[model samples]
Target: MGNICPETYPDPFNFNPDRFIKDGKINPEVTNPEAVFGFGRRICPGEYIAVDTLYVLISSVLAVFDVSVPKDANGNPDIKPSFSIGLICHPDPPKCSITPRSDRHKELVQNLLNSDPTNE
Candidate 1:
């Protein structure tokens, strides 16, 4: 109930990261979206680590790839965000294209993959 509260977050249904930003910086007054990690005494202890790891992972991926919704035959972006209903909401396999942003990024990805010790 707290997660989707329109009073705390304007246009709650919309994916807007800008809501937390003000004057080109994170707004201190804006409430942190920490409800997913639980609340009160039962709040998740690993939430900080989890959020940090996610930030690193997402930044790394964005540095190498240009991720976008897959285009249809008519060249229209096919974007329909759907999720499975359950205890843990899981998003459906996205219909998207994750391609290297440039030749340099492609080489960087290839190099990293090739250097993986587990691949041997």
Candidate 2:
């Protein structure tokens, strides 16, 4: 995993999906980041479902919300995205501003929350 990342991917820490696209197409030359799923016999069994779940979750969030870095009192963004290295590397509680994009989006989220079975 270390070999494929920070080397094959330029500025690996940043989320730059454009590396996979060139000339309005998915560049075949660049290595797919999904290699983290493992390769050959060590491949994960739940890779397909995991990828699908991520797609659904990401798309759903993007569809209803506008995500950005929270601005300071001076109207300057206070974004300092840092990662913590551990058993599993993850962002160190980066601040984000997620707001419903529109009234319809707000309603959609509210309806989903209201209809949630676990909330009963």
Candidate 3:
């Protein structure tokens, strides 16, 4: 009983996160993916914090970097993506490019690194 069911999520295998959005806001009618944290009284107590942290982390990364499929030697996108099945499902790392979105973003990252005491 995963959230990947076709009845609940159309074309669930495809990475269409925009399905959860409608009119510039999260669509309440869409099934929430919180089932991964369990259900009812047995639900993980840290779920809120975990989800919030993930939102912040992902937003931060997207703000600073441009992530996309990597180009092959011939300059065509190498877009093969697959996942491993288990208790915790996760995508197998695909060939992708992650670069700072701009010179300002790169400088911001450098400034962050320079300010970290542990980096010394």
Model 2's alpha-carbon lDDT is 0.84
TM-score ranking, best first: 3, 2, 1
lDDT of every predicted structure (CA atoms): 0.85, 0.84, 0.89
Q: Residue-wise lDDT of candidate 1 within 1-120, one digit each (tens)?
A: 765688888877564678999999999888887788988998999999999999999999999999997777999775666789987777788777789999999999989989999987
> What are the models' TM-scores?
0.76, 0.77, 0.78
lDDT of each residue in 12-97, candidate 3, tens digit only: 87767799999999999999988888989888999989989999999999999999887789987666668899987898977777
List clashing residue pairs in candidate 1. none
Query: Which RMSD values do the candidates have, in order?
Result: 2.9, 2.9, 2.9
Model 3: lDDT to the true structure: 0.89
- Per-candidate clashes, comma-separated: 0, 0, 0
Clashing pairs in 2: none
Best by lDDT: 3
Query: How does residue 2 of candidate 1 score in lDDT?
Result: 64
TM-score of 2: 0.77
- Model 2 stretches astray by more than 4 angstroms: 1-7, 71-80
